[model samples]
Target: MDRALLNALFDEAVAKAQPELAVTRFLPAQPKGRTLVIGAGKASAQMAAALEKAWPGPIEGLVVTRYGYGQACERIEIVEAAHPVPDAAGLAAAKRIVDMVAGLSADDLVIALISGGGSSLLPAPADGLSFEDEQEINRQLLASGAPIGVMNLVRNQFSTIKGGRLAQAAYPAKVVTLVVSDVPGDDPALVASGPTLPLKGTRADARRFVELYRLDLPAAAIKLLASDENLAPQPDEAVFARNTSATIASAALSLEAAAALARQRGVESAILSDAIEGEAREVARVHAALAKEVAVRNRPFNKPVILLSGGETTVTLRGKGRGGRNGEFLLSLAIELDGVAGVTALAADTDGIDGSEDNAGAFVDGTSASRMRAAGIDPLAYLANNDAYTAFEAIGDLFVTGPTGTNVNDFRAILIR
Candidate 1:
């Protein structure tokens, strides 16, 4: 199997979601009055840059993205902050964005460039919630293994800027949100906790998730959730009546791009799903089962076919090891498919960085586990530690692509030849 072919397929998926290509198509007509842009996510900065190039009218605003994911935009301000965790930088930027949209008139237009990672990138705590408390809440939710839907409900309920508050602030004005979705089913509202879209569920729903996930939230966070504050603006609210949102890029779209490329190159391909979710290792086991079936028995799709899937997976941190969700998934797949010939796979985050490591993901083949063992590293021991980054590193299989400038979620492909 050609590792280069796998890499090319990954590149095609990423190119399909590039901000410059996707954002321009979803951009609304230039407003009659001043256009203000504001957003937050891994792709937001690049999205802003794309907007500036495409929009005819003058645009000025702020967008926050994960550190090192910032893009250079002449008119729009690109603010870099911490991600998968909130920081002082994110809080300040979120505050500024909320303030910026206030006092807008009905004639004005506000465009929100939202994508994955926006939840943590825009951490404007609600009233009486401290920054430290907000940070703790994020850390707890991420480690809790909660699905994105539950996590979004909890996060949006506690945020002053998210959960449609951004749109609420720009109310009376026409707000358009162009999203690069990284969530299951490409739900725009779930993207970045729906900063510009209306809130769904209830505070009680958020509280239920807190308890369900057993989150060790800060006292202030608990109090906020328990309080009967103004419910986040609902879909029926007048403010959202004039607002509009579109998913410009998504896991489904990117997966289709990869599958299309494979078929074009004479390799039969099938997409099992574009919305799978669960613990990283557990998901790997399921995919491995399907791959082994086709590879050995040729029961499902026959040989010389590529299997593709896209979805976000969670990792419950049992041991303090270095890896992103994609790394963890790939490592687990390697172990399950040990010594099986003519099989290769790649699992990566579309935005390039996977978890805490610089590598977007890692490449694994039938002999990946054996390679680790030959290098005196135990595959099971490494996966147990959540140390897939180091495990792949020892065997020179880590895929390092710094910040691909777009995120549609996790991309996984299996080649059975």
Candidate 2:
């Protein structure tokens, strides 16, 4: 398959998740009192723009997005903030969003456009919790190599806007949440820690995860998690009576769009899973084994088929390398498939920014390792140092798409000819 075909597949996956296409149908009927738009994540700006076009009545509120991911919206205010880490702007936005939803009458309406990266973008510290404490906890979570769900579970305990607190503040008012899921199993609550959705686990559950990941949380954070009054509204709470949530974009639909394109091109497509997780390098090794098996024996799937999978993966940050999980996965995959011919693959985050880098992800093939070696770069050393960005950038294989204004987690395609 040509490289253009791979690009086409990735583009199709992203196009399928566009809020312009997904939000219009999910919009609720015109409200009686006021229509308020509020959200936070990488896709909040695009979603706000889409909401402006779809809602019949006047809709005005605030939404926060990552830097450079902002889209112009006349009615809804678009604010840019730091992502994967909370900055003053994000903390301020979170505070404003919570205040916006407070004291609303039952006649009013709240529309929440939640997506990936919302967890860090909306960092409203609960009672007695400080912004610096939340930021430190976020840093710990991102570096802990824990699953996204685990990270969300622990962080939400310290946030006032997360774990359904936003909706709780919106109380009698009807809250409609349109989510672009970036979490495994497409759990709506897990997306951006479910600002408008109900709280997940109990305080005990949060403490358990903190211990499991061995997160060195601040003493205030630990004390706050122990308090029962701070727990966000549960599923059975009356606060969620009028609150409704829908996952507008997800890895599942995005993968199917790519598979459909592959079928139209006469290439068999197989979807492995949409919720794969764990360490990036380990995941890459498994994918490499699958590619080799298909190339050698075609046991699970026939030849000339593209194996597709989606879901977020974690990276254990032991080395001070500049690379995201997708790039790390590809670098490790390249090493494992060193001499296995007839195999090429691409892995990228749908958000267009993998980790904090500009590139979405990278590509790999059988000769990738040798090519790096020829260029005086040791594949094993790069992989060990967690420097996939440098390695792939040196070889001109990084997939740079800028900000696609969406996040469906990771998309990986392995083509075997």
Candidate 3:
């Protein structure tokens, strides 16, 4: 397939998997009592709008989203906050949400809309810990090169509302959660750090993660974790007895949708894996080998095939880089492909924000390196410096779709013919 057609197909696949469309199909019947909405993520606001349009009863509550991801809703308040890092706005919003759900009777219904960014967007630190303590620890964790699951496990241990504590706050209120999963395995507890589900990890596990990752934590944080006064909610609590949650959308679902689009275009498709995880560059190298194998020998699959995969990938930041995981993966893929014939690939975060960069991700074809060389650029040096965004932008190949209003994780597609 040509470049334009491939791009169109990829974009269509992402659009089709948006939470606004996906959440509607999984929505339950109108509650007999009052409806209370609470959510957090990059897509929380958009998800709230979807609930408003679908629900038949009066709905009121608050949802926190990343800055610039807010959508208008009449009854459901949309609050903007920071992501990949916590801020005062998120801390305040989380407290408000917890308070709102408190004292709710079993007759009331609480519908939680959760997605990728909810971990950072909802920052109710456990007692005796400040938001600054949480923020500093989050920064250290992000720079520590640890996987998302590990990071979230640590996060759950430090928060009051996460790890099923939110459900506890709601007491007997019936809580139904609609989640757009961005983590591998689609574990409901790991998504947004499992605010509405029982936390499976323990304080010991959280401390082990910090030690294994060598995360530099503040003295206050360490003290708080050691104190029984600041311990997170336990998993065997009665408050979790009536809570229920479901993944309405995920990275795997998005990848399958993309593969279907490729097949409809007369191109065969295969999903490499829905739960791929590892170092970004190493994952790119593996994908490069698979794409070349399919393109040349068609061993795994025939020619004119699209290889699709989804899952969160991590990038170890050794250098001062200006790219996200998807960009790093694309850069590594380009170097490994080395102008291989009849293969092109796109790697991008479905949320439209890659790490803290402006672009969603990037695209690379067989001639990508040559085109960069012709433009007096060096892909390897940029890759070393973690500057994939600059390299792709210089070649006019950076994929920039600002805040698609939904997130399910990363989407990767390799087309070979």
Give the top-scoring candidate (lDDT): 1
Q: Tell me the deviation in Å of residue 122 in model 1.
A: 0.9
Predicted candidate 3 versus true structure: per-residue lDDT over 1-417, tens digit per residue: 466656776587677767778888887766777889999998889889988988777889999999999999999999999988988899899999999998888888999999889999998877677778899888888888788889888887778888888888887899999998888889878888888876677788888988999888888788866765556677677777777788888877777777777777888888888788888889999999988888788878888888888888888788886989999999999988887988888888888999998999888998898888888879899888988888888899998889888787888888887
Score candidate 2 by lDDT.
0.90
Clashes of each: 0, 0, 0
Runs of candidate 1 exceeding 4 Å displacement: none
Of models 1 and 2, which has the larger lDDT? Answer: 1
**Per-model RMSD to reference:** 1.1, 1.0, 1.6
Question: Please, what's the RMSD in Å of model 2?
Answer: 1.0
**Per-model CA lDDT versus the true structure:** 0.91, 0.90, 0.85
Q: Which pairs of residues have clashing backbones in candidate 3?
A: none
Specify the poorest-scoring 10-residue window by lDDT in model 1: 222-231
Candidate 3 minimal-lDDT segment of 10 residues: 1-10
For model 1, how many clashes?
A: 0
lDDT string for model 1 (1-417, tens) is 478999999999999999999888887987778799999999999999999999887889999999999988899999999998998899889889989999999889999999999999999888888888888888888888888998888888778888888898888889999999999888899999999997578888888888888899888877778889856878888778888899999989899999999988899899999999999999999999999999889978899999999989999888888999999999999999998988899999999999978999999899999999999989999999999999999999999999999999999999999
Error of 3 at 238 (Å): 1.7
